[model samples]
Target: MSSRSPAPPNAAPNARAVLAANLIRLRAEKGWSQEALAFECGLHRTFVAHVERQARNISLDNLERLALALGVQTYSLLMP
Candidate 1:
């Protein structure tokens, strides 16, 4: 038998969760710290953390800021 554990059950889809996961993935792929991304986005580090944690309902303007900083379209963040 394989040593790897079975995949966990899939959770229900959520917009905020999708955005948060995409943010983490993109940031890691770019080797950027949350602080670095915040600087690039012209937002506070704590605010970026909150968004990553899905602790806040991110605003459209901020979404645009993040997309611009990440060099992606805003809809990319919203996509599943």
Candidate 2:
């Protein structure tokens, strides 16, 4: 029998969750607080928190800023 579990209706897709999850991971990997990332990205710290929580949709420009601050390509944030 298969042990696979059914997907949740509200769960983020693998691709999207990976993107959001990576944002959090990369920040931690760099030993940065959300406030630090916000400062480096020229954004408000609450905005960083909103992004990490997937509560806010970011524009490409903001994504680029975050990528630059994280020392990664913008696409890296979308990795699965």
Candidate 3:
């Protein structure tokens, strides 16, 4: 028998969550604090924290800035 159980309503992974998880992982891999990354990206430290926590809906321009600061492609930030 299949072990998989159906997901409840609204249980699907959202883009913000995926982005948050990826951002957290990448930031940790680079040994950067949210403040440090924000400084590098020329953004407010609180903004970075909000993004990492999936509390803000980031824009495409901001995404590009983050990718450039991190030396990664913008699309890389969106991948699962």
Top candidate, metric TM-score: 1
The regions of model 2 sitting more than 4 angstroms off are: 1-16
In model 3, residue pairs whose N, Cα or C atoms come closer than 3 Å (at least 3 residues apart or on different chains), thus clashing, are none
lDDT of 1 by residue, 1-80 (tens): 54544545895557788999999999999999999999999999999999998788899999999999999999999898
Give one clash count per candidate, in the order shown.
Answer: 0, 0, 0
Sorted on TM-score, best first, the list reads: 1, 3, 2
Using alpha carbons, what is the TM-score of model 1?
0.84
lDDT of 2 by residue, 1-80 (tens): 43546569996565445767988999999999999999999999998888887667788999899999999999989876
Report the lDDT tens digits of candidate 3 across residue range 1-80. 43545557878666777788888888899999999899999999999999987778899999999989888999989887
> Which residues of candidate 3, in runs, are more than 4 Å off?
1-12
Q: List TM-scores for all candidates, in order.
A: 0.84, 0.79, 0.83
Model 3 vs. true fold: TM: 0.83
RMSD of each: 7.5, 6.8, 7.0
Each prediction's whole-model lDDT (CA) = 0.91, 0.84, 0.87
- Candidate 1's C-alpha lDDT? 0.91
